[model samples]
Target: MAAGRLSFRNITALAPMVRVGTLPMRLLALDYGADLVYCEELIDLKMVQCQRVVNEVLETVDFIAPDDRVMFRTCMREKDRVVFQMGTADPDRALAVARLVEKDVAAIDVNMGCPKEYSTKGGMGVALLSDPDKIEAILKKLVTGVSIPVTCKIRILPSVEETVSLVQRIEKTGIAAIAVHGRFKEERPRHPVHCDYIQAVAGAVSIPVIANGGSLDLVRTHADVEEFRKATSASSVMLARAAMWNASVFRSQGLLPVETVMEEYLRYAVQYDNHAFNTKYCLCQMLRDKVESPLGKQVQAAQTNAEISEAYGLQEFYQQTQDRLQTKRDTLQRSSQPSCPVMDGDIITMAIKFERREYPPQITPKMFLLEWSRREKLEQPRYKTVQRSQDRAFQSTVTVAKKKYRSSLWEKSKKFAEQASAIVCLRVLGIPEGRLGEDDSGLVCKRKREGRSNGNSEEERGKKLHVEAEASEPAAPAEGEGPNHPTQLAGTL
Candidate 1:
């Protein structure tokens, strides 16, 4: 039971959030005091197939430096602090991808916590929970194949005994650490986090156990962090959605307004030249609390990164928000302290109250976009048929009952729709689904081959480092039989 298993000195880290967690977000988290960060879950085979291509294609982009050759998802500022996570069912693919980015990252984390159907349907993510033997084999191969540390992230089971046993077995694989999301596969974000189970697992495992879920309270984050640390006694805590809302939550002081947070994030997005969809998604999350306000309505209706910038008023908004925040802070400080040097009569206890104001209700983005589209169709009768066709296609995709496939279609459609229109209409207009043209296959092939050259040298080094334990037969745990399947298909964290 060595204390050295945990690599980072500080306990706070950012969780791997799909799409929302980008390189800019990672760097921002590190800048604000997060000890470590993780890139979102990348599909193992897809990464192996396309890593070279993604790198090669993006190399010409000015923002991506030469040092980011191996791991384009990480930046120079936090290369040593970022870990790469992947979802995979195959041991070879897992090892291949782990070795692919070992030099660029702090460690490699296998995602066993994802409850989305796309992951489970492919026998990856939480599906491995049903077969612990497979989990051990995959992890063993990764540990033996790479020079850097290997770890895993997992969801809890129904019984504490089963959960504790699952972690103990993983510990024997010589993993550096394990992060336990304190919820069952069936539990959603709103469900109560099972801290008791996290505590049980932490007590059972000798390696560092990081506790996650339900501890990130956006309004009372500092208190929540302390509570989670005290309750689980785990090595550290992982902040997922809360950090997305406010990366400054990693900083100990100051309660930043939603507008300020959005402005800061926009600056990062500009510096990174993040994809439109990802940049827009982060804005949506940041404005979750302000969606009812006038500015919020315009922000939500934005389709492109440029529209988002315009809606936010960019630098003007940043300066105004900063002034407002400073004024509030100065007033609060004045109200809290005494004015006189000496006491006269008995001091009167004054209950200083701050005024709470809610933004006025405004037309939502959905309503505005829907109305705006109708007006355009009426004004331009000639373009009506084309608009109708696009709407029908989007409707068909949404009506389908397949949750996994629907989510996939929705994202693709949303990406295309946003590009065509000036506003992101996923939450607004049910737009048309974009079809893949004849050139898609060729595009895919080129992307797959992008990073192939660099992987060749690493593959040789990986083979030489493989341990004999990777060849042993690992038995599956007899405790859990059926797949610990997800309760629903709609979830991302």
Candidate 2:
């Protein structure tokens, strides 16, 4: 392997799970002992369009190095170990999108083995498996387009010879590695994974070959991985659901207790802001061994990440699990007692402690919880302040819109007044009246439309006209005849 490129030191890698394999999960795997880790498979086009997906899946450092690509996804700690996998059918599209993210990853992997309908329907994933020529072209384009090494992950074909031939053909395209999932495309989780075929493919390919599938059994995952490597003769072993159950499978020290692993994983979840579904799925997997426990039921029933976290109560749960394990250890340590090597519940923890007594003391559960709590507390106020700022900004926008509306209304009223005043001036300055008529009070003028007053109804207009006529005509005097002195003459008459 070249510098800054992928090197399988431990030969244990994390598989690209669609929802479950996130940045936090990769980080957890790295901490445990995975030599290489891949992020979830992203569709080339969708990955380019959806920044929310990027944010949800990838977590970068607080600040960036000068040469860092803005789309860089992983945190500072695991940048060198993370492989970005994309699903694409078109060579142009693959090359175009590959350039967008090549600088940030250790290597770029083409997802050639997804069996789901959604993936196949899009002419990507396992759909590419049917067309090796197209796959070769895609790999060629990607290798030429970006500086990073390109790899492809594929499922096995029916025959071992055909599978080996397929790997050999793909290796000719200059892919740095080939990740072979032992099952055929039509195979499901319930089916047994065929490691014999994976071994055949590994023997065929000169490039690094990674074996994936059926390595996620909870108790036997680590053992299963060892068996898988031995059986397949693979350069590396990739884990999907197994790492979710307990990331510690990568460590040679053996598996940690589920409670201990879950607590550490939750801390990573908070630290990385993993998607809720990812968090929930991991929680469910960890609680599998404790299915009869109330905590397991509570975790299953929880709808949100916060609720799940609360139900687990990391510190309290770890304390209880550790104490129970410790009690079991004390019980076993007694020489007088009948020597039973394995106790029932916390055998995993005992195995770990017995293998390496210095393990628990190195990073105790309390220490991890305390560190996570401090970080959470520091982040809370910052989050609250951001929320407050957003609220204030929203309120300000509404206020500005309201003011604009009021100003618009006022401007319209002012313009209407000016137009009305102009019409009145035209009438007063000897311009043609054109049937313009004022009301009796002279406060408002009614314009005539086709000889009918616009302001009043027909009956009211007739009444107003009659009143105007009576006012215009000379009024008949009272029965008395003359003006001033005639008053006396009228009285005499």
RMSD to the hidden true structure, all candidates: 27.1, 30.7
Predicted candidate 2 versus true structure: per-residue lDDT over 439-469, tens digit per residue: 1221222232222666667667656654553
1-493 per-residue lDDT for model 1 (tens digits): 2224338433789999988778878877887778889888888866775343222212211222232222245555666778889999999999988877776778899999999998999899889899999999999898888888888999999899999889999999988899999989988888778889999998887788888895444224645676776687787888887788788878887457767777778866654446556777887787776777887777667765566777777855545544554455445544654432222232111211112121001211222233344444522101000111111111111111111011111111322222222122322233321222212222112312232334556454334322221232122222222222111121100
Q: For each candidate in the order shown, give its overall lDDT on alpha carbons.
A: 0.60, 0.59
Flag clash pairs in model 2.
Answer: none
Worst 10 residues of 1 by lDDT: 380-389
Which regions in candidate 1 have their CA more than 4 angstroms from the true location? Answer: 1-10, 53-72, 216-219, 315-493
The 10-residue segment with the lowest total lDDT in model 2: 390-399
C-alpha lDDT of residue 241 in model 1: 79
TM-score of model 2 vs. true structure: 0.60
RMSD of 2: 30.7
